[model samples]
Target: MIWSSASAGPTNTLLPAGGCTLLPRATMYAPRMLAAVAQESQQRCRFCTRARAPRSQSAGWREVRRSISSNASPAWHHTRSISTSHLPRAPLAPAEIAPSKRVIFSGIQPTGVPQLGNYLGALQNWVKLQDSQRAQDEMYLSIVGLHALTVPQKAAQLRQEKWDMLAAILAIGIHPDKTVVFFQEDMPQHLELAWILACCTSMGKLNRMTTWKGKLAALQSASESGEATITSSEASSLNLGLFSYPVLQAADILLYKATHVPVGEDQVQHLELARDLAETFNRHHATGQRYFAPPAHLITPTKRVLSLRDATQKMSKSSTDINSRILLTDEPEAIRKKLKGAVTDSERRISFDPEARRGVSNLLRICAALDESRDAHGWAELVNERGGGSGMLKSVTGDVVLAKLEGVQKEIKRIKGDKAYLEKVARDGAARARERAERTMREVREMVGF
Candidate 1:
């Protein structure tokens, strides 16, 4: 029953039943024109008895014309006879349309061996998504070496860290067959697209990000600790890469046309910038078509493991106190000793009050993550029932953690030994990623008149 504009003059409108209704040019785009035609057709004709059903192909055009002519008013006689063969194809039925596959993209920096916070906060969720996603879903995981370059690094150490990160990703149960794991530095298109997006991004927007400010604060603290005061000139000489890091991040997501991005709570602001830049490109650069879809946030679980030395801050690799975080590759003895020395309150009883007893609650949270059968409160109750206090809680948490990491550590060691296999995996992943990126860039180049 819907009316669509035809290729003919403005006075003519095409109906789904292979006929043209003549109307005034002013009413061509009006809904009332459709309503009046529908009302008249229903009262006059028998062919439109079931208004919602598909038109039967068996009813020839001559028969339809005769039916309308016999029943329609004098005004209806002006309807033009058109061949059914000349009609536009009917819209597909709802059940016949195929659903779209999800395109997912996420990245992590290659700074060092992933710690407990990294595993629980991001990597574990990635493994869960890989196992649960549909067969046709596409996933891309990148070791963002470019992002790491925003800070100072040793050449040999950066190379080793990249390989270590790749090993950890495989060790954590993210299958190469299910996910495309590659290094971000391998793709030049990432940088090229980054430059393009950077031109569209505003400096004021980048200034609002908190990560760069944190980096500057860390830099100032480091300089002061070394007994060197940073003058205004030295501060002004900060690297541009550190300030505009989010622009590159936005390019990474937009280049892939990702529909979903997995990110931690702290990184949500960067993802929001990606969405905004996508919208800006579609509104101005796209030629009457939305080429990029704004990616949605797939927030990971709230497994924010805090530092053992300072409960107020997140666990970080940059912490000078090695005891503050547990690396994934730590030996069983090291794991036990670190947990034993973890900072907690003077109260003997175990509790899960994060605001008051952050250190104790962090231990309980880790235990809950390792053993999903119980939560932090449940673990606290069990430890209290054992009547051993903080010592017993640490012991219980250590045992579960050791058991969980045993397999991962062994796998990482095995993977690291075979350098050839890792190279092959990287090459295959880069090839696949390049093919998709090239296709997107081709269309983008043409759209921007390159």
Candidate 2:
């Protein structure tokens, strides 16, 4: 889950690494006091479970609550609900569409690899959600090529990147059949819905968004010299597409009428924006009749996996240093080399102190995330078993990362080899998405008298 940098709290307590549990969605954000806050000021705030949007009648909220009560609760696993939404679009049967089995929507930009943070923070959670799932309640995972264009790109290179990322995601076990997988740019309706939602959105709201602020910060930092200072004018040199991108994101959610959005904590603000827009539009056009229900955040509970070489920074595609990040397609040898070369504190002890030993602690965090059993206890034992040294922790963590990545690499190779099949899948998935998006957009347009 992504939130304010200062606001991030312990995503999981290491009980043992052997087998961590799939926590109930609610528990992900249960008030665990943070040492990061002043001792006297410490308050119980939902850490990892932060959502970008709000909806009182959100189907995702009910599903997530029920998910926790059932999966982690031995007493209530068998209970079922019939109907949760008063909206016309609400899912009909709640019993069969249990949280574990409910439809889910998550997408990523095909802007090459997002570094270790993306993999550990979001992708791993995707695997868990996909694997633990029971029935085939709809799951659509998109490689959003369209989202990529807010920045510049080469057409040929971008196309190849799109295909490559799809294979990579697939290799990571996103079964195209079990989940509807597609390229977002392939659908005309994504843009269509984006336009409809944009009408409801204000320029003022878009201007206040943080995405452009981040870009501006990155630009300023890169250009900073001992004597140079950047101005807001320099920042505003960037254009509208980047600023208004969230409107498109809102459209993505509304187009799917996605009850649940599997979002990292960072995206909660954006999701909240989406919710606000959805509610505003729904209310504005209700004509004393309700339309779309608000979307709910399916907060993912994976640690914000940091850089292997730099604990201070999140692993990112933008990192200038080669060793700072790990790609999903990294070969076992490359993974080993990267881990072996990782930055660790001079201290010998292997512990989870993010404050004192950022580097070593970062490795430990990654190990915990990739822990085969997802058990913190098993991970702790493994760390202790590695002789309680930083080197051993790095070694063990490297092994675990390699092991987890092995299948992903193999699947990527296989999928990449079949370009024709991949294109066919993308085409089919796009068609389906466009159909749904168009349906929603048409309704939205009529509601707005467009």
Candidate 3:
């Protein structure tokens, strides 16, 4: 199964029951107590947890109860940033394929070259799922064009951006043959499924969504200091897209009846909503076996990557400062510049203290995520491997980052030139996605007497 990262939605395939990690009930339910939080943050503390890291470092899943400034950085610039066609190459197929036993699905937006944060946060983990070769699993990599429509857009421009994003996905080694790669808008099933799920979804549930609040805050901060009052209408306008967008997302996962949804720590709340909806729908339909198997979620193994300029904030395209993030498609020169110019503490000594030194530590997290060795893969690894006495963490971390991204940079350049091929892939993917989605949608519609 293949997966291209897209927020919007994706294709369907029967994936084998691949190994999936789950949080202990205690972790999710009693997600407080500084000791518990500290222990969790010590291990895979995503960017959000770092800001509140405890004095004592801990490790593993008990270490995961954290939040983030959260991040994504593919919104590319017009300049000769990193182009997809010119860099080194990643494999087109995952290291392994699933045995026919279960199904799994995931997606990401093809904004541009994925940033280090995007890679570590989501895509890098996707590669691992591909290679697992579990039975009963079919993976789909979808370019969610429809989900991208939370805001207004120029038809011509968006169309091209989607095309560009698709190429980057293929170039990153998401096997076209193994995974269903397609555009979400091409399949009517997604919307149909979404509409059905929305009927069962509660307005109260939507209100609980953090996406709206986060976005409103972001907008407020971006506005002038004395910029009038925060009106519901202002927030309402921005809300149409990314905010009310969750029902569709729940539909996206359940449409495929996915057993597992790979997400960043920030997206867990949305996944929980999906799980809740699945249970509600099953009870309503009264099927012998559960219609949807309250899917499990797995966050990427690495600590979440944060902004290069500011650790308090997650890396994002929405940031007004262009320098805050390192776009995946950015040229080596640009990346080097960003890393070199990255904000660091005045003290020259490089250590993995995310709380006091966010800028440099962000760089370390990025490097550690893409590292070949286990010690560098997780956040607590920072403290575990050499927390007490520092080594060449900074310089070494820089080299690791450069090595990991080289392949992605090269692939993006090559794929951009083959737009025709990319289009075909998208079309074929849409056909496959639609076929699977219709089956799920048929049952959903019938349940509600559509």
- Using lDDT as the measure, which candidate wins? 1
Task: Mark the regions of model 2 whose C-alpha exceeds 4 Å error after superposition.
Answer: 1-102, 113-115, 131-136, 215-226, 229-237, 373-386
- Candidate 1 displacement at residue 261 in angstroms: 0.6
RMSD to true structure for each model, in Å: 12.5, 13.9, 17.5
lDDT of 3 by residue, 1-450 (tens): 112211111111111132112232222222223233333242322322323223253121223333433594322111111111122222111112122354567777646456566666666666677766454567876767777767656788777777876776676677777778888778778887777677778888887888767776777885667667667656556755566577777778888877667766566677767766766666556341256655556433655777777778878766788778877787777777676657665554455666766765776666656764644335435534554223334445556667877888788888888778887888788888888888887777777777
- Compared with the true structure, the alpha-carbon lDDT of candidate 1 equals 0.73
- lDDT against the true structure, per candidate, is 0.73, 0.64, 0.60
Task: Rank the models by lDDT, top first.
Answer: 1, 2, 3
Q: Please give the lDDT score at residue 12 for candidate 3.
A: 13
By lDDT, the better pick of 1 and 3 is: 1
RMSD of 1: 12.5
Question: On lDDT, who's better, 1 or 2?
Answer: 1
Clashing pairs in 1: none
Candidate 2, 1-450: lDDT as tens digits: 122101111122222222212223223233223122112321222433333222232222211233223345431111111111222322111121223335577888885644567777777778777786667466778887767776667999887777887777777767766777888877777788788778878888876777766876777676775456556665555867778888888877777766667776567778767766766665556442225445566655767767777878788776788788888877778878888888886565556777877887777777777765645445656777656776787788888888877777777788899989888888888777677677877887787777
Query: Which portions of model 3 miss their true places by more than 4 Å?
Result: 1-100, 215-236, 287-289, 374-398
